[model samples]
Target: MANPTACLLIIGNEVLSGRTRDANLQFLATRLGELGIPLREVRVIPDVEATIVATVNEVRAKYDHVFTTGGIGPTHDDITSECVAKAFGVPWVVHEETRALMAEDYARRDPPVEMNAARMRMATLPLGAVPIRCAMTSAPGFTMGNVHVMAGVPRIMQSMFEALAPSLTGGVPVVSRAVHAIGVFEGNIAEALEAIQKRHPDLDIGSYPFYRPTPGSTGFPGGGVALVSKGVSLAEVEEATAEITAMLAAMGATPIQGEPG
Candidate 1:
């Protein structure tokens, strides 16, 4: 059977404004791949309620699983939880268990912090949502239907995902093989690469050019093209990689196994 597909929604104004770079997409993509859920689409939107609600509704119907990160904090702009609730047409309510947990933790603070309205906001979730708890914080992310909401902080997000991963269903994990053609420009092998891709239509064949500056030689920065073949079947990936290796050798370039250095 084909692996389940997933979509990631990164919600934050800081990300769009370039004030904070998004660090969750790559991590989620890689981890989802390992769990046999291919991350097929990603959308980065500001903390606009309409946009977040519309995007959440759109992608949740399109993909088997949906992950959202950001805007679940105490600040005013942190509105992803409410937006998601709106998307699901569920009333946003406070989760008592999470609120109780947070209250307990806050009581143990050095200064005995109070669970103010802002801090209590983190415990609020969509009606009927299941809390996704992590060790990093008392406040929890939640799972509402197929959508898994997580914190935007990389460390906290990763912990939430780790806690939630075991419950997820998966299929055969996708695999990849790569060969770097040293000293070969992409133009030198574009036609051959296209031919290879045509021959293996089931696999994803890609050529990426990179520059690796030689220690002392200032000659064109010394780079090459990397040919990667990705698929669910290891045999198919190996077969396509072998063809790529042969193509590079035919062009008089040494094909180095794996990624470019």
Candidate 2:
């Protein structure tokens, strides 16, 4: 069978408006990659229920797993849990396991936390969903069907992922190799790179230029470009890497193995 695929839905008006910089996507992407699950699509949407509902339904249907972050807090703008329930045609209710955890957490506080309507909202989840909790925070995240809803906070989300990853089985991990040439220009190597890419269609090859501290310092607009090749097969990666290195050498530019930064 093929590797598992996933989609990430980032929910929040703040993230979309740039008020709050998103930190969960990259964290999740790296963790998922390590687990051998390729995260194929990522969408950042507002707090609108309809948009959330539609996006959740769409990606969940397309991928083996769906992960959503943010908007699960107590504020009115926190609407992800309800929206997910609507998407899955399940009822959103205060989950007993989560509530018990919340109770235990607050009971130990110097000034015990209150489980008011606002605070109680944190314990709510879609019916039949399982909770994901860890030392990062007691505020639980839930997994409903193929969709796993998580906290937006990087630390908490990472902890939740650690707790959940072991249960999932993954295929062979995708491998990546990057080569940087200090004095090479992408324009000079574009055609060669394109040909190499065509020859290895299964690989994902990319070129990224690094700008010099002072423009035209080396008479080149940018310092150099890094050629990166990514794929699952070890032999294919090595073959593409060798081709890229040879091409750079032929052009009188030394291919520096690995990324610049």
Candidate 3:
């Protein structure tokens, strides 16, 4: 099956300045993987209109799907919608549906909904775009020309992504299983692990090492290693997991069945 290609654009000065660590990339990456979509590239840009527009246009032209996170909040710095509109060469205006949603949400507050101009700005959208609503936030997202505009807030972005999953074109789901090795560092078994990965070119094999209190020791987490394999077929993951597990055991190490909780 053909893999559905996607590119991610993270727009925020907070993330770039190290003020906030991005959570959307990992969330979207795993979620897309589950839906059989492989993320091809990711870019992080400051909340600048010119840069956002350029990156949006670039990714939309290159990938089957382009997902953007951040810069959609109800603040002056938020400009993703306008930038997207400009990139698509479409008119930008206050979207009535989004305004209604925002108004209704604001009405639920202790005080009556204040129709402030800044809050109203959150309702603007690009011309000929579809509204992407979410329960997490009232600011609606938009989809135009394969570009999906989502919220800067991680929760709202995730909700929008979930709602839009049905519209995405994806390939076979990627399935994976992990094998754990106790008392063995990653380097000791790196050669065998690399061999298994080489033998299965179609499968993606990864080795992750963790140091924690020892498993058998009380209050002290165990430090161990994990081998994970992902592919289009469950059988492929299972086969790779089995082979790698056997290899680790033969090297005088204990291969645990699953990754530690």
Candidate 4:
């Protein structure tokens, strides 16, 4: 069977404004790849209610799984839960079990933390949603239909994903093989790479160029191209990688086994 497909919806004004860099996409993409769920698309939207509701409704229907990060905290700007509820056309209410759990955990604090209205907001979720518990914080993420909501913080988001990973259905895990051609430009190998890609239409073939400064040198920087082949079939990836290596060798460039240092 084909692998399950996923889309990551990153919701935060900080990310779009470049004030805070997004670290969740890479982590989620890698984890999903390991589980055989390919991350097909990623969209970074601001913390707007209408946008979040619209995006949630859109991606949830398009992909097998949709993950959203950010705006789930207790602060006033945290409105993803209600927006999701609006998107699903469900009532937004305080989830009783999650509320009780958070209350108990907070009561055990050294100072006996209070469940204020703001803090209680963290326990709110859409009707018929399942709370996702994480090791990092008392506040929980939640899953509604195909949409899995998670924290914006990298540590908390990773914890939530790990907690939720077991429940996800997957398919054949994708693998990759790379060949680095030393001192070779992508323009020199683009045609060959395209031909190889055409021959293996099921695999993803890509060529990336890199350059590094030589210490204490005024001359031009040294660089090379890294050709990568990815697919569910290990044998196909290996074959494509070998073809790329041979192509680089035929062009009189030294082909290394992996990415350039």
The candidate that wins on lDDT is 1
* Candidate number of the best TM-score: 4
Off by over 4 Å in 1: 213-221
User: Model 3, 5-61: lDDT tens per residue?
Assistant: 899999999999999999999999999998888898999999998999899988999
List the lowest-lDDT window of 10 residues for candidate 4: 217-226
The CA root-mean-square deviation of candidate 1, after full C-alpha superposition on the true structure, stands at 1.6
lDDT of 4 by residue, 108-159 (tens): 9999999999999999999999999988888999999999999999999999
Could you tell me every candidate's TM-score relative to the true structure?
Answer: 0.96, 0.94, 0.90, 0.97
Candidate 4: misplaced stretches above 4 Å? 215-220
TM-score of 3: 0.90
Clashing pairs in 3: 70-152, 212-221, 213-220, 213-221, 213-222, 214-221, 214-222, 215-222
Q: What's model 4's lDDT at 120?
A: 93
Measured with C-alpha atoms, the lDDT of residue 153 in candidate 2 is 79
TM value for model 2: 0.94
The stretch of ten residues in a row with the least summed lDDT in candidate 2 is 213-222
lDDT of each: 0.92, 0.88, 0.87, 0.92
Considering lDDT, which of the candidate structures 1 and 3 is the better prediction for this target? 1
